[model samples]
Target: MPRALVIEDDHKIAELIKIHLKDLHYEIDHTLDGLEGYEMAKKTNYCLIILDLMLPSMDGMEVCRKIRANDIASPIIMVTAKSEEIDRVLGLETGADDYIVKPFGVREFQARVKAVLRRSLGKFENQSSTNNQIIEADGLSIDLDKRSVQKEGIRIELTPKEFDLLSLLAASPGKSFNRQSLLNLVWGYDFEGYEHTVNSHINRVRAKIENDMNKPSYILTSWGYGYRFNENI
Candidate 1:
């Protein structure tokens, strides 16, 4: 059975999530402390992680950061009562694959979980089906199956979302993907006005892969439209 970790402080909320996840046939591990959740995540390979923004010992942002810093690529769904726009954006920026606001309908919550898991599974299938998995340009190498990147022969770590974003652009060289398009394609959700979230992820990827962020050579701006992988690289 596939397992999931739920790091939530509220008993009611955690119970709600646990019940639904069990319905999806997942083995669940529940914790009220962020530190314990982080430790469990580090030691186990869960198919999904349901993380709350507020918890004892550590905040969700720090926990998410630490998990991603360790290159644990499990899909994460950040659950929180805070529905502010900034909170949602920060959750994504911190490496959560998806986010849900509190007091949410059971249907919406379940839908988000299902969508994230579907996308995660799709990535694995797509990777395994392709024999030609590496895309190279200007000394940057992206291994599609392995989900790894090396810039100028030096391995660079990227969050799972970052890797997905980069892979999409690199595979379609010179195709200018507007922010909304990227948001839909990479995130599996159409967040209408949250284009800046895409911009933030792009900036982080550029910072890691570019020799100079000011003069980026791989990812180029499309002036009035969006971003594209440099075809002439």
Candidate 2:
């Protein structure tokens, strides 16, 4: 059973989330204020965190920044009423693993939580494995243990999801994986109907690794098929 922390100010919303998470066999701890929530998060060990952007005593962004600054790598999913693109981008930039808008369906929220947890666990397992440490294709290098990628001897920064998606494709160069397959492999079993997630991350990865994202060289699209890494470079 995975442990989770819910930092939400709304009692009703928190209770609803707790009910859903309980059904999923997760142990949950919650706080109503941002300051208390941040303290609880730091003091306890949790597999994931469901945080709200608007909170009393402190702001969600401040808590997120503090958590990242403290080097807490536990996956965090922001739950916010604010649906503005800028707010979403800022949440991601602050090291949030994912975000959910208010009035979200219970099913979708549960799925997102499971997906984030699965990705986090997959990374942990990959890091612990010693057999498949690093993979190189052409000038691109993927360090599974370090969770880093490099091209032409220069480090390329990638979000966690971006790294996982790219690493999966690079590991099996030339093997095409459709949107749903990629979502299942990278986002986990619980992910559903969020293929756009894969598309956006792919674009970001290409922008970093390829000379031109518009004309990607290493990661190639298979038209109506899907995406595959070019093994021959």
Cα error, residue 186 of model 1, in Å, equals 1.4
Model 1 vs. true fold: TM: 0.84
Question: How does each model score on TM-score?
Answer: 0.84, 0.60
TM match of model 2 to true structure: 0.60
* Cα-lDDT of candidate 1: 0.87
Residue 200, model 1, lDDT = 83
Residue 104, model 2, lDDT: 88
Candidate 2 lDDT over residue span 94-163, tens digit each: 7678888888888999888877866754663433454777888778888886777889899876656677
Instruction: Provide the clashing-pair count of each candidate structure.
Output: 0, 0
- 132-158 per-residue lDDT for model 1 (tens digits): 679899899998867789987888977
